[model samples]
Target: MSTANERARMTDLALQEWGVVVGILAERGESWPDTDVTRWGPGVTAAMERTRALCAACSIVGATEAADIGRLADLYEARTRS
Candidate 1:
């Protein structure tokens, strides 16, 4: 069995991986454009919300590893955001 700290590290990896995936999905969501499918669509928005939840959960991990992922993601996101 893994030690407590090792398990915690695994959890942090999971959270941060989810965070990066969430960021990717969020980036893809931006390309949908202002079409009827984007504006009048419930499914697309629901998916976006679900994807965002991964990132939200990452914040709750509160681990240094997860935080590092968030920081890296933020820097990557900044390039895209600009």
Candidate 2:
């Protein structure tokens, strides 16, 4: 049984992995990109649920501290430019 801290860590890791995967996909600029839900729907959904469940365990308090979101936005811009 994972404790709240353990679950939060797992969720963080999962989010990081997803970010990396999305970054790679964005870099490739695929013509027919599959939706994230379709590709890893179950896992993504699970991770999100876990993250929400462990929301209190999250270290970051607000949007201002969300560097990952900024990174994702940059990736989106790069994809559009290419």
Candidate 3:
């Protein structure tokens, strides 16, 4: 668990790491438009729907947890590795 301020900080860290992912993709002469998935078949779209449902239970529109921010950082790392 994390305080709101801590979650905000982690979000910033995750975003900065994602910027590195973008740089790595740019070096390979690829961009988002070139590698877009037609649509998330099931795994991602279903997860997104579930996440939205959980978020709806929160009183805040954009409430977030530290673990969620950490997950974003993990996704950024995976993107750079792939």
Candidate 4:
């Protein structure tokens, strides 16, 4: 569990890392195209959905935990590796 401040910080960090992932994908010719899932495939759609879920969790009180943030970081790493 994390305090509100901690969750806020973690969420910001996760989003920043996600932004880096998106940039890397863009370099590889994968553009997000602003919510147009048809522009990308299911994998990218899943990543974006995860990002949106993180944001949703952060908005609700006590919804986001330390482990959740860690999972997002791990997901980012796995995406980068593959």
TM-score, every prediction: 0.36, 0.38, 0.40, 0.47
Winner by TM-score: 4
Task: State in Å the error of residue 71, model 4.
Answer: 21
Overall local distance difference test of candidate 1: 0.47
Per-residue lDDT tens digits of candidate 4, residues 1-82?
A: 6587767675665666467547756766764443445666666666666666665666554534323545555555565589
In the order shown, what is each candidate's alpha-carbon RMSD? 7.5, 8.6, 9.1, 8.5
Which digits, one per residue and each the tens of the lDDT, describe model 3 over residues 1-82? 5467654655555445445444544665654335444543454345444443433332142334313424554555576589
User: Candidate 1: misplaced stretches above 4 Å?
Assistant: 30-82
- Prediction 3 global C-alpha lDDT: 0.46
Note the Cα lDDT for every prediction shown: 0.47, 0.44, 0.46, 0.59
Root-mean-square deviation of Cα positions for candidate 4 versus the true structure, in angstroms? 8.5
Q: Residue 20 lDDT in model 2?
A: 51
Minimal lDDT window, size 10, model 2: 58-67
TM-score of 2: 0.38
- Give the better candidate number (1 or 2) by lDDT: 1
lDDT of 2 at 34: 51
Better of 1 and 3 by lDDT: 1
Off by over 4 Å in 3: 33-82
Clashing pairs in 1: none
* lDDT digits (tens) for residues 1-82 of candidate 1: 4455754665455444545455444555643223344353555555545534544544465433333444535544554578
Number of the top lDDT candidate: 4
